[model samples]
Target: MKKLLIVSLGIIGVILVLSPWILILFGRNQLHDHDIPQQEQLVDDREKHLILAIFPHPDDEVTVSGTLMKLKEEGHEIQMVCLTRGEKGKSSGIEDEVELAKLRTVEMKNAAELIGADHLHLLDYPDSGLEKVGLDSLKKIVGELIAEVDPDVLISYDSKVGLYGHPDHRLTGRAVEEVFLEKRGMDGFTPQEMFQVTLCKKQIKIALKLSSSFQKNYPEDPKQGLPRPDFSINTRKFFPRTLQVMQAHQTQQEVLKDLMPFHDKVPTWIYSRIFDREYFREVK
Candidate 1:
């Protein structure tokens, strides 16, 4: 019994040490397993266009940074509106809410600049409290921004997944959807397209299987349906720039740093295979 216990402990240690690599391999395989659909690149004759992305917090922009960069490269303007400063987010150190919110604001500004966004609007809503916010009030605030931007393209989270069921994410997504639908028939307010940032259901399933830590943080919920992307943007060319944008969020590094392995530690082909695409479901 003593010998068996010793061997079990050793195996557990080894598994823990190798977990990251195992997850990477699993992710790579999962990408190959899916027959991902791609759409023809968008072409617009307009000399200048505006894209407005509404998200819940500071780091949420990273979810679509690569796609945003591609849009900017195509001579379109990109703007971001974060509903909160992430005051309730986990701190890397001993920072209080006020200190953390201030830090995140600067980090977001830097990230926006790196992504070549034309503007960023930071709405100082209370973090972790969006669910409690009045729907009409949230819609009014977002509606005002939509009116000001008159964006040609709009982006936000998918209310279905919210990529792990974060309440703020779901709330923000709902608000954006409401504003988009409400303004569609209004004169001069119809956006050409609206998309929700999302992950493939297969990818999420594989991630849950490979990382015990991820599973612990985001338990598998059969009821939490996934979004089926209407089209996927090939962002392989801009993946490096995307990483740069993510790195700019300095205070969020502890959470973001793990993403580096997809760029650095993995083979270039593997990195491209797994992360060179950003998924989006078009809102009709």
Candidate 2:
């Protein structure tokens, strides 16, 4: 009886250690079984096209890095405007806000370079506090960027969905939308396409189930509508570059530490299951 008890405890320990690996293998196999088709239609008239992506924080850009890489490869000039330097973001070690902001700025620049972005506009809004910014102020800043870049394509968060319901994200989305709407009919200000960075409801549900970190950060709220993706880019080909872009944000390592085990050990197939596609909603 004593030996049996010892064996049971040993088995539990082994299972605890191996469970994450098991889940990753299972996920990879499932992805292999259910293959999704890649989008092959290229952009029309690609000569000297410009794209601008606006997001609330430095790391927020990772969500769309795959799509950005694809656009870059297709020869469209890309730029990113990060509203804040992420001064209020969590740091791996103890650091003051000013120091953290400078670190995140460098990290964001490295990430933008990896994605082949032509320019990175870093705004001075307070991190995690964008909601406090007045609407006029928000509009003025984004409007100036739009005028300067005159982007052919614009990408931003969805105000309605507000990925993870972050206040900064919501505010950024609203501001972008307001500016885009206000400038749509003006000469040389209208973008050919406007896309909201988003995940499919199905993917979001799966992520919520699989990632405890995601759950902690974004508590499920039925009040918020789940965005239905009107467009999707199969990012399987750009997944490695996306991972590299993410890795460039070294200061935010703790933010992704939970997934590193799978990221480091699992086959790229795991990423195919997790981040194979970048989804968006077209804002007409």
TM-scores, all models, native as reference: 0.82, 0.81
The sequence of per-residue lDDT tens digits that candidate 2 reaches over residues 129-180 is: 7777876888888888898888888899987756766778877888888778
Candidate 2 pairs with clashing backbones? none
Residue 77 shift from truth in candidate 1, angstroms: 0.9
lDDT (CA) per prediction: 0.77, 0.76
Q: Name the lDDT value of residue 83 in candidate 1.
A: 91
Q: Evaluate model 1: give its TM-score.
A: 0.82
Q: Cα lDDT for residue 13, model 2?
A: 97
The runs of at least 3 residues in candidate 1 whose Cα sits more than 4 Å from the true structure, single-residue gaps closed, are: 1-28, 40-48, 210-223, 257-264, 267-270
lDDT digits (tens) for residues 1-284 of candidate 1: 99999999999999988876676677656663356676434336356678899998999999888888888898888999999998877647735999899989998999999899999999899998987887788888888888888888889987665765677887788788877877787787857778998777666666566544346545356666557677678887887777778777777776664434345566665465467688788888
Residue 42 deviation, candidate 1, in Å?
5.3
